[model samples]
Each structure stands twice: as C-alpha cells, then as structure tokens.
Target: MFQVYLIDDEIWALISLEKLIPWKEYGFCICGKSNSAKKAWDDICKNPPDVVITDIRMPGMTGLELLKRLHDSKMKTQVVLVSGFAEFQYAQEAIKHGAFEYLLKQVKREQLKECMIRLFTFLSEQKKKMLETEAYSEKQFWTQMQDQQIKRAAECLFQIEKQEWIGKVCFVASCKKENIVDKKNGKMIQVESFRLFLLGERDENAYGLCIADQEKSSKSEEIKKFLAQVSEQETVWGISRIGDGTQKVSEMIWEAQTALRAAYFSQNQILSYHIKGNGWKKWDELSRAMYYKQNTQVRMQLEALKNEVEVGAVLSDELFSILERIDYEYKKSHGKNLKPQEWIRECDMIHSYPSDKEFFRWLMVFFPVQSEVGSDSAQYIIHLIENQLANAPTLATIGKELGMSQGALTQILKRQTGKNYSELLLEQRMKRAKELLVYTNKTITEIAEETGYTDLFYFSKTFKKNNGISPNEYRKEKRIENEQSTNEK
Candidate 1:
C-alpha cells in the first residue's frame, strides 16, 4: 500500500480531507496529517511518504516551498496541490513545480478519486521504468569493468548512485539455473552466466549492508543455513575484499574472479581472496618462454604453474594475457596470419574451460609445434623465401635456390600449406606491409617498396584482399585502439 501525507494551514481543511477521502479503499493509508507546512516538511524528511497532498497557501512555508524541497531531495514522492483560488497562475506554478495534480478546494468525491487513480497508475509506471534503467546501468557498469574500461564503468556507477554499494565487498557466484533469494540489503546483478552480489556488511554468513547489532548473530546463522540449503554440486562462489570506492570496482571484480578460479581449481564450494596467491610472475615467465620459442622451458613453466594452481594458487588475468602473447608469437614464428575474429573465438574457447589443466591442454594444440613433415617443409620453404624477400623471388628463383623444379615446389607447397607459391609469396608480402604500417611511420610507397611491391596500387589491392581492409584503414584502426587502451589505463 502507498503512504500519503496531508498538509494544510487550515485545520478544518485537513479534517475535511481526512473524513471525505476513502484513502484506504483507493490503496492509500494516511501516514501523517499536519496543520503547518513546516511541521509536515520535518515529518516528511524523517519518514518520506509515497504521496503528499498539501494546500497551496500556508503560513511560514508555503506548499510550493515544500514541493521544491522534496524535488531537491530527490525523494520518489508524488505531490498534489489543493488550493482555494482557481487562478491560472497558481495552477501553472503547481504544474511547473512537478505537482501530480492541482485540485480545487471544494472537490467532488468522484473527481478526487479519479485523479487519485491516475496518479497511482503514473507512479507505478514511473517506478517500473526507474528499476529497468537502474538494472541496465548496473549491468553496463560491470561489463565495462570486465573490459578494463575503468572510466566508462565509473561513469555508469556514478549515474546509479547507490551509496550502499560504496565500500562494500563484492561476491560472484556461479551456479546452475536456480533461484537465489536476496535476504539482506545486498542486490544481485546477472552477468552472462554468473550472478554478481555486492555485500555491504557481513555478519558471519549473512550478506547485507543493514543489520542491527542484536540481530547480527541470527542473521549470520540464517545466511549460513541458506547457503547450506544450496546444492554444493552445482554451485561455487567467490568473495572479494572490501571495496574502497567506485573507482576500485574493477580491481575488486578481478579479485573476485581470481577467487572464483581458485575455487574451481580446488573443487571448493566457496573461495575468498585470502586463498589467492601471486601467480602472475609465473605467467610472465611462461609468456617470455613462448615468445622465444623455448619449447622445453615453456613446457616446464606450464607444468610448474599447473602444480601451483592444484595446490592453492588462484588464476589471474595474466592467464589471458599469456594466451594473447602466445597468439602473437605463434603468428610471428610460423608466418601464419589469423583474423581478429578467429583470435577472439580461440580466447572464448579457452575461457570456457573449467580448470587450468584443461586450458593448458587446449593451449598445447592451439599453438602446435611444427613437428609434422608437411609443417616442417612449409616452414623451411617460407624461411628461404623470407631470407631473400627484397629480391621478390619468383617461383623459378625459389625452386632453383632449393635445388628443385618450379612444378615440384608448387605441388609440395600446395599439399603442405594449402597455398601455391604465388599465393604464399603475396601473403608474406602483405604481412610485412601490415607490420611496417603498424610498427613504423613509413609512407605507403616506402612500405610497398620494402615489401617488394614497386606499384603502390597493386600493393594496396593485395593488402585489402588478404586483410579485408586497406593499409591506411588498418593503420588508423590500430592507432584508435591504442589510444583507447591508453585512455583506459
């Protein structure tokens, strides 16, 4: 039921309104009645009602002044103005001040009831819209945090100013499809397949911001019982340390994810940051080994890292960073080019794995060694071509260098790398051109010449055909991405 407050300077007017209006039948309860606007204002501040009805003219503080105060306070209260005078200016002012309705002093019961119904409907719709917008903003904020777009995430949080969310501990729970109840003041936000819960205060197991001292122990027991009721076979949770402010939301989320990964690895029902260890140093070592193509060292480091996780170490974002570095190194080492979309799909596949061991196994195949005869032969031929790339070696020059006929070399290349000599040469040249475009501020003509292409137009055509974007367009996109990344940092 909605609460309503009535205020007027005239005692008779207040009594008449209370006696005549069937507030209870219309889904409203008279919360407070005051003869002075000042008293009403004080009472509203103490306990704001859902709707307020007041006479326009009052001593000390007029109804307009009270409306302005309520608007400034940002309370979700609907206001209706009742006045003795039916002047156009008074009604216009009431509307300007956001009054729900302006009614004449001697209003008929039927007219008053109709206005009340309309106001109730309007409030209901407004409440729904506000909730939807808040939910959307909350979801967007968390997405931005995950993407490392800190500024954008902060802006989203600022828009949805929930003071309780500040300085709260964040928790993330991954579970099969099941309904989770909000027993505390904490709120649950759905993110893809996970539910993120922000706990402002904790009493043992109870997760909420508002709890009386006397009820703390009972609340904690209640929360523990609730968690015990959940099926451990299908649920895992990660809890973050207390957050400082909105700015630290991203950091807190990362911590929560780290804890969650640890829980998954250890097969625990719940994990907290206390169990998190420094695993990024090992991740960095693994990345460097992969970059230098130290196969033995990479394998050793990966095995050690896996052992560490099995014991208790939590996985960090550096895990994904290592995968990205491996992808870059794989392309550079093998002379294979993959589109960004393909790279993203590979990352998503890795992220879907439930444990570190499974992810490592996938990575082994993802960056396979060139041990097969076909792959080794392809790499050898590519190496020979790269050694004399400036000469723009033709099929005959390449075959002669390798002591084979052009026909034999063409068939071998096609069978191994799925591309003939001419296609491979073009692809190599385009890849070099792209590197020059991104790593060096060289003119298109100079880059084309460096890549063994004398004709700029032909070079551009081949680049566009191979990469689906022209050289200049690719450079511009890379620069924009770099700038955005810098700003995010």
Candidate 2:
C-alpha cells in the first residue's frame, strides 16, 4: 500500500482529515501527520512518502514552498495541496510548483477518494513506463556491447551520473555448434558462435557466480558445471576477473578473449585470469629435461606442467613461447631440416593432441635414434625400425628392405649393437610403452594397442619384466615422484 503523510498548521484540520478519509479503501495508509509544515518538510526529506497532503497556509513554510522544495529536490512523491478562501492564490502557486491537485479546506469524501485514485493510477503508469524504458535500454546496451562501442555502451548500461552501477564480470563460451542452447536458463546472450553473460544482473546471477571471487568452492563448482554443460569436444570457455563499475566493458571482453585463446591453445576447456601463479617456470624445467635427453625427467615435468595448465596456471603467450622453444630446440639438436609446409603440418599435429603425454609421443617420432655404428646400412636399418615400431617389424622385413638374407641382418645387428634383431625390436617397443605409460592419460589397453601389443596380458607381463613393475604401478610411481618434486620445490 502507498504511504501518505498529512500536514497542516492547525491540529483540528489534521485530525479531521485523518478521521474522515478512508485511506485503506484507496490502497494507502497515513504514515504520518504534522501540525507544523516545517516538521513535515523535515520528515518528508528524511523519508520521502508516496503521497503528501499539506495545507497551503501553514504557520511557517507554506505548502506552496514545500512543494517547490520537493520539486527542486527531484523527489517522486505526489503532493495534494489544501487551502482556505484566503489561500486560493497560494493553491494556484502550489499547482505551478508541481502539486498533483489542490482541494478546498472542507474536502468531501468523494472528492478526496477521486484524487487518491487518480494519484495511484498515475504512479502505476509511471512505474510501468520506467520499467519498459529500462528494459529497452538494457537491450540496446547489449547490442552496442556486441559491436564493441565501448563509450556508447557504457553510457547505456550504467547510470554514471547517478552512481548506480555495481561491479560486474563477463564470460564467453565458444561452442562447437552454432546453435547451442543454454540449458541453465535462457539468460545467456548469443552472439554468433559465442555465448556471453554479464554476472551482475538479477536473472544472470547464479549462486553468486562472480569471476572476481571464483576461488571460492561454491562459485568454482557453479562455473565448472556451466562450462561442462556448454562445452563439447571443440568447445571451451573463458572468464574475466571482476571489473569495477567504471571499467570499460570492452577491456573486460578482451580479457575474456585472451583467456579463451589460452584455453584453446593449451587444450584445456576452461581458463581464467584469476588463477594464481604462472606455469612458465615449470614449462622451462620440462624444456631443460628435453634438451639434456632426460626422457624420464621430461615425461615427469610434462605431466606436472599439464596439471598446472588444467588449473589455469599459465598464460597463453607463455604457453606458446614454451611450445615454440621446444620445437626450435628439438630441430637444432636433431640436425633435421624441414620445408616450410612440412614444419607447419608437423606443428598442427603436435597441437592436435589433447594431453601432454600424447603430444610427447607424437614428438618422439621425429627424433628417432641414429645408429652409433655410423654405417649407411646401419642407419637405414635404424630408420626402418623407428618407422615401423607400431607394426612390430621382424628380422625378415628388415632383410627384405636391405636386399639381404635374414641371417645376414641378424649377424650385423648382433655384432654391432651386442643384441639380436628381435632383442633390439623388443627394446624399442618396451621403451615406447614406458613413455606412453608415463606421459599419456590413455588407458592400459589403448597404450598396448599403440605399442603394437594386441594381448593386454602379454603387454602387462612384458612391461613388468622390463620395468620391474606393471604399467599402472609405473604411472603411479612417476606421478608420486612428480608430486614430491613439486612439493620440495
């Protein structure tokens, strides 16, 4: 119900209006009454009422002056001015100062009720119009934001002059499909393949999912679920940290875009700037391990670095730098030269792997060991072995490639490397299996297939014989070691 305040200099006049007017019947209640216009003015300024009824000729500060004061203060309270015959001119002046209506000192029940009804209807219509205008303004602001009109968009989205804007955060989801529907309510704004949300608005606020305080467990879970629902195999999301009321929306958008690029390049589905620490130092450690040909150290460090990336511990530029440095260092050490097109294709394949271990396995194919015997035939044999490890090539296949008998190839391998052809092949297969076990998130069966072991039990027995542990045990040992090393550091 609307609150009404009654004011008059005479106590009898205030009491008569209070007792005669059935305010509840007109959807209003008299919240206060004053015999002094001065007190009424002070009360109204402190707690502005929806409707104010005041006499024109009060002891000090007449109703005309009070109405003028309210108009100057820009209060939304509607005022009804009352006057005696001596104050008719004062009532006209009250009207000029924005009073809702003026009434005689002797007000009838019907006349007062009519005035109250009109006032309520006007307030309702004005409120409806204001809400509609605000909705339109919000829509326009979003449209302008999509076009990146930063200054104009800010003007529409915030009431800067009134200081009414609150802090906000933005999220951008790049979906695999063009027409992805938002399962978490229809609050997300779709722009092309991107789904964007501003988190300060009422409808968009989910469990207080503000990016500024995303480290909180509840907020983190909300964000995780949101990303999972929107993301597919090729989809990812980026979130911007909290931006203050005055910060430009365009800058927030750019931050989110940068984070999204990081997620895309790192093959992680979600990333944010708010995560603590940097992954560059860990990445550098992995690079050093690779440079020194410490295969075990490299695998361990790579796994640690992948964990850091999944937790949003790296920036996009730093991750890219690490990747490029690895490529450059590998090419320099191996003395392998590739044409421009070939290098591009190889880089594409390296980036296509979803996990660090898979990427490491793909990279190992390029740096196959050259035979230490230094013979042209020996080098060719090593190349064949490296190229066909996935096929588990035999002595007969090597002899056919070299245009020699299997017996001759066997003698050459035994004399030069102190191991037979089958022993050498087993060593290569076991070495690859260990690398896959340490580095990839692939299952045991998948790793076995990749290493040319069709029988899971046979692969497990061979791995145990070679490494003194099963594949799963080896992975666990390496992971524990990585965790210990990380803790020590």
What number of clashing residue pairs does each candidate have, in the order they appear? 0, 0
TM-score of each: 0.33, 0.35
Query: On a 0 to 100 scale, what is the lDDT of residue 10 in model 1?
Result: 81
lDDT of candidate 1 over 242-328, digit per residue (tens): 333444444455455556556665566655554334434676777677678776677777677666556554343445555666666
Question: Candidate 2: where is the Cα deviation over 4 Å?
Answer: 1-166, 169-218, 225-235, 245-248, 261-269, 273-279, 283-291, 310-312, 315-317, 337-358, 366-489
Q: Which regions of candidate 1 fall more than 4 Å away from where they truly are?
A: 72-75, 148-489
Q: If candidate 1 were superposed on the true structure by all CA atoms, what would the RMSD be?
A: 27.8
RMSD (Å) per prediction: 27.8, 33.9
Per-residue lDDT of 280-368 in model 2, one digit per residue for the tens?
67667766776786655766765666666566676554544456667676667645321111123223434555445455445443433
C-alpha local distance difference test of each model:
0.63, 0.63
On a 0 to 100 scale, what is the lDDT of residue 365 in model 1?
36
Best by TM-score: 2
> In model 2, how large is the Cα lDDT of residue 131?
64
